[model samples]
Target: MSQITTTCPWVTNDPLYQQYHNKVWGRPVYDDRELFAKLCLDGQQAGLSWLTILKRQANYEELFFDFNPQEIALMTQDDVERLLLDTRIIRNRAKINSIIGNAKAYLAYSQNGANSFSQLLWSFVGGQPVINHFNVMAEVPAQTPESQAMSKALKKLGFNFVGPTICYAFMQAVGMVNDHLTSCPCYLESSAKK
Candidate 1:
């Protein structure tokens, strides 16, 4: 089968971006570790480009205990201090703190029988993907009411760095919503899946 190059300019041309685009970008990720990674990365990407965070993902994994919420939740102030000095990923103090804080919140949620981050997130969409038939990148929305509601709920549940825009990006990353342009190959491929 022939591949349709992505219509999203950010995903075109670059091999790494293209690989992520074709494989993981719009794919449903249910693993807790992966969900945490996406949430952390999306939060870190708040003031930066997605490509920037994508490039530093390996570093993030190394520094953040493989995005394991339980492990990250146990991190101490010394650990935060150590991460602050690392130049491999974004060195922002607030971002670093948010990662640790979010991990703690994740653990709390799990303890309360939330169980899976994927389950909690996907529930907002009724366990179905919000398929947007966008013909152009501009037609894609930055934030939706679903995201707004999610952001509010997450904050209420103690998660930080989870504003509406960031939540929307998280939703896109984890495939709770497929923002792929209609002409893109993965759009149809993703929609065709159960």
Candidate 2:
């Protein structure tokens, strides 16, 4: 018989989603570029499922110059119009523009001090993951005080589509907070890191 897998119930049986859940989601990401990319992808998930954004991630990378903030920051209205027509990625004009706008904001934010974008974000959690032991999916929250503060801060910096809910999802996705159920094998591993 197939080995029974224990993980967050949100994970579907699809190979792509499974891979993301088992290997990538809730895994701490310290790289600045990777963090920026994740933030933008989470923004794209505003009105859709995370799986939908994940499926088109490669296309996003290709079309958005591998999510290079410097390059994307330079994208103009013409580029937005063109990208809105591309079927490979989400065709929402506002969503597309938000990515570009966020890049510019990220670049500016990164210039503040010794900290990179990753450092700035992780600092909110005191440079470590806040591990929570939820027993079920219902216990998982859509937003938290930290996420609310993060959303406000990001908005102050000119980033869009970064409401509390989206910020919470970003936090979970980047492993800034471990929302994995206690019984899940990944929980122990995730909660251990600083």
TM-score of each: 0.94, 0.95
Error of model 1, residue 31, in angstroms: 2.3
**Residue range 1-194, candidate 2, lDDT tens digits:** 12336478898888888778767778899999999999999999998999999999999999999999999999999999999889999999889999999999998988777577887788888889898989999999999998999999899999999999999999999999998898888888778766
Q: lDDT by residue for model 1 over 80-184, one digit each (tens)?
A: 889889989898888999999999988888788755877888878888888888888888888999999999988998888899999998988788888888888
Q: What is the lDDT for 67 in model 2?
A: 94
Which 10 consecutive positions of candidate 1 have the poorest summed lDDT? Answer: 1-10
Clash counts for all predictions: 0, 0
lDDT of each: 0.85, 0.90
Best by lDDT: 2
Q: Which one is best on TM-score?
A: 2
User: Least lDDT summed over 10 consecutive residues: which range in candidate 2?
Assistant: 1-10
Clashing pairs in 1: none
Clashing residue pairs, candidate 2? none
TM-score of 2: 0.95
